[model samples]
Target: MPRRAGAPEVNAGSMADIAFLLLIFFLVTTTIETDAGLDRMLPPIEPPEEDVIIKQKNIFQVLINKNGQLLADDNIIGLKELRVKAMDFLDNNGDGTCTYCKGKKDAESSDNPTKAIISLKNDRETKYGTYITVQNEIVGAYNDLRNREAQRLYGQDFTDMEATYLNPETPSGVRDELKEKVKRIQDLFPQKFSEAETSTSN
Candidate 1:
């Protein structure tokens, strides 16, 4: 007897469906990451009771125009001189307090060391780099004051002193105190360093 011929069968109808289901699954399950933003300290909403308003007199106003020109108390100054003037102002409180030493007044009506307020006003179009430079200078002044205070509290050349016997934990308290003092100084000035927009366009 002769063998009967059989028909070859092929199944191609479900290939597209499998691919579509896989694509949908991947699309539904995948997660995309978002970028984190810059970190900064923001003010609180509610005003606290017994807010002691310290009258700010030693105001050093720094202005930067769109042209990158720097002004201290409305007087034009170069970058080098800006640092010098800022250091001077920080060192000497207009109230006769030596900012560097932070000395207190004696029984007599004498001068006590006080901190000054730095009011920075920049044009609306002022470059961010210029603003950062001014900010760095102010921070540097505070760091210098901190170092001086540390030297006075501890012995001279404290950096070179060994930590063999001294309690390292005690310095943490000192650092906290210094940080509070710096906060006070920073608070003396308005937290909003930039001023309102000027009428003239940059």
Candidate 2:
């Protein structure tokens, strides 16, 4: 018998079943993940009861241009000096309540830790990386001050104490105590950050 030259037929009877099995397997084994975003607490939305006037000397201005260049108090500054400059401004304590502060006490600087404020202004076109880095440096300044105060008063690091409070299994009483300790440290180096809108064209 001579075989006719024609396209060979394939047995596709199980093709649908195989594809369905594959879909079911993938659906069962694959795990979908949700996005994990930057973990930060936002400020309260309520407006202040009264407007308070702050001295220009007590306000430390930090400007980040669209080019990522930094200006500290109108003076062009490098990233390396930002932390130190912020620390200096915060710890000046010219009002003389910060016994543990080691600042130079310049009259033109902050009058006290309570009075010190950092005003951050950034152009709309600023790079996200630059903005985050600058924010980290400013927060690092506050953390350094808190850590020093925690060590001086409680003989423990601020992070360790924070962990004790943040743990879910911690007893409510113990957490309350830790909260008070954390509050004390915060009182010593209050973080007063104000964000300002600037012209994006710059």
Candidate 3:
């Protein structure tokens, strides 16, 4: 027998089916990663049953000028005094109900210090950095208050301070307290207002 013309020689098989199956498998099994969002606590929409409204006070106002000058009430103060003032305010007004610093109300007095609101007014031209610094100072004040409360609650002998000074294990209770303080500040400034002195100057 001689060679046949155009003889078909086959060895393996079709890969089209395998490729199609693989495409289907990938389409069925592949997962895309999504970004995780920031964690935050949102306020409730409904009003509380008691409806005890706290009045805004001059003692609680901290104003920032366009020049980044800070004023506590009408008096110009440095960041150091700001923390001191905040602590004093919280110490005076704090009710034991506060998670941060539980200040006892004098037997004769009705006003609660912890319930006192800190009103922050920033000029329109104030840098975000200045605002953030003020916020950090405010948070620092709350942290100080929380630490004081911890000392009062657990006594000076507590050893957790060393651990707290380290990473991650520090009680979030202080941070939670700071968040509440920030929430109160946010409530006070529902709408941004120019510092009274700044408004008058312009």
Q: Pick the candidate with the highest lDDT.
A: 2
Each prediction's TM-score against the native? Answer: 0.51, 0.85, 0.48
Predictions in order: lDDT = 0.57, 0.90, 0.59
lDDT of 3 by residue, 1-202 (tens): 9887896888557777888999999999999999665222454699887976655541368888888899886789997789887766655533344344344543322134435556678888888888778877875665665555446655531224433443465568865644444444333222222223334237
Using TM-score as the measure, the top candidate is: 2
Q: Is candidate 1 or candidate 3 better by TM-score?
A: 1
lDDT of 2 at 102: 88
| Model 2 per-residue lDDT tens digits across residues 56-105 | 99999999999999999989999989999999999998878778898988
Per-residue alpha-carbon lDDT of candidate 1 for residues 1-202, written as tens digits (9 for 90 to 100)? 9887887778989999999999999999999999664233554687877775544435567888888788887689987677666656555544543544443332222222343556677777878888778777765665555445545655332222322124466577666644544444433322332333342443
Better of 2 and 3 by lDDT: 2
Better of 2 and 3 by TM-score: 2
RMSD to the true structure for each prediction, in A, is: 9.5, 2.6, 11.3
For model 2, what is the alpha-carbon lDDT of residue 121? 94
Looking at model 2, the pairs that clash are none
Deviation of model 1 at 84, angstroms: 1.9
Task: Please give the distance, in angstroms, between residue 186's alpha carbon in candidate 2 and its true position after superposition.
Answer: 1.0
